[model samples]
Target: MRQLIVTEFMSLDGVIDSPGGGDHPHAGWTFKDIEMDEAAYEIKGREQEEAGALLIGRVSYDEFAPVWPKMEEFAEYNAMPKYVVSTTLTDPQWHNTTVLRSLDEVAALKRGDGAPLLVHGSANLAQNLAAAGLVDRYHLLIFPILLGGGKRLFAPQDAEKQKLKLVEHATYGNGVQMAVYDVVR
Candidate 1:
């Protein structure tokens, strides 16, 4: 079975929304604070290379589709197979894109054998996947700053006790912490 890896750029206060210039007031906070070094770029490149597919939400897909395709850095992301979970998203203009309408479909996709399905910046989808015990691993790049009011990675309503085993951790020169956790089932 393919592992569902939830990768997020989050704040110290657990806020995951608008890390890179969005509608949120704390937009571009990650860019403003954390200095991306060669190591960071290498890490991102490694993750992209390892991921066979991307499972993202409609909002994330809409936010990324136009931009990632234009950038040379995200060429791998643009070329990889993508599954966007949205009932309302009809036409996916990006190449190798498919629209998934239900959670059952998502679960089925998880059962298939492949490289890790990397999920990026899809807070709603991530929450659902976590709640369903579908997320196999979490790769969080935590910035030092705290954004008190914003969409969080884990909300209050998500009260289920899901145990996690710390697999790896590292800190960059800019004080950004990279933590990898395995969801203990």
Candidate 2:
């Protein structure tokens, strides 16, 4: 089975929304709260390079499409295949991206034998995948700050409890915590 990895930028308080920029109340939490050193940025770039493909939710797809394609730093990302999990988006503006219809379709694609799928900054999609037991692993970059009343990774109404085995945890010099976990069932 192909492994599904969900990657997200989260705050210590579990806020995973608007890590870059958005109209949300926590729009600039990541911008104002944390700082990334050259080493840390390089590590993040390396992580993005290792992924075979990127899976994104609609909002994330829209947000990233305009920026990543124009970014020279993300040339690798532009070259790799990108699958967007969206029911509403009929067309995607980004190059090298395709749209998947449903959760079952996503599961089918994952099981059909291909390289690992990396879900980046798509919290809603991540929650759905987590609830459906589709996510095999998680790569989280947890920053040190509390952004109260921001979007959450897994909402409280989601009663599912996912057991995860912590495989690795590394603290960067700039106070960013990186953790890798495999789903334990």
Candidate 3:
């Protein structure tokens, strides 16, 4: 079975929305203050390389589709199979893209034999998957700064108390702590 791994860049307070510059007031917060080290880059590259397929939400798909195709660095990711979970996204123009409409479809994808399915920057989708017990693992890069308000990685009101076991952890030179956790089922 393919593991559904959610990798997110979060603040100390657990905010994950718009870490890169976007409509959010606290946009570009991740890079604005701290300098990411080569270790961070290496980790991201390794995650992408290890993934058999990419699963994303509509918001993330819209943000990535236009940019990744034009960048040479993302050639491997562009070539890899992508499944975007969206109720409204009908025609995905990106290469090797499939639009999935329901949680049942995601469940089916997880049951398939493959390398881990990696998810990035899809807070809403991530929350839904976590709540539904579809997410198997979490790879969170926790930055030092705290954003007072923004969309969070885990919303307390929407999510039930799900236990996680720490698998591994590393502190990068850039003050970002990379923590890997397995969902305790």
Candidate 1 yields a Cα-based lDDT of: 0.89
Candidate 3: residue pairs that collide? none
Model 2 agreement with the true structure over 25-124: per-residue lDDT tens digits: 7677666767755654554676677778889999899899988988998888899999999999887878888999899989987896766788988878
In terms of TM-score, how similar is model 1 to the real structure? 0.96
Measured against the true structure, the TM-scores of the candidates, in listed sequence, are 0.96, 0.92, 0.96
- Local distance difference test values of all predictions, in order: 0.89, 0.83, 0.90
Which lDDT tens digits does candidate 3 get at residues 45-117? 8887899999999989999999989999888789999999999999999999999999899999999999999
Question: Candidate 3 regions off by >4 Å?
Answer: none
Q: Model 2: how far is 49 from its true place, Å?
A: 2.3
Cα lDDT tens digits, model 1, 110-133, are: 899989999999998999988888
- Cα RMSD (angstroms) for every candidate in the order listed: 1.1, 1.6, 1.1
RMSD of 2: 1.6
C-alpha lDDT of residue 157 in model 3: 95
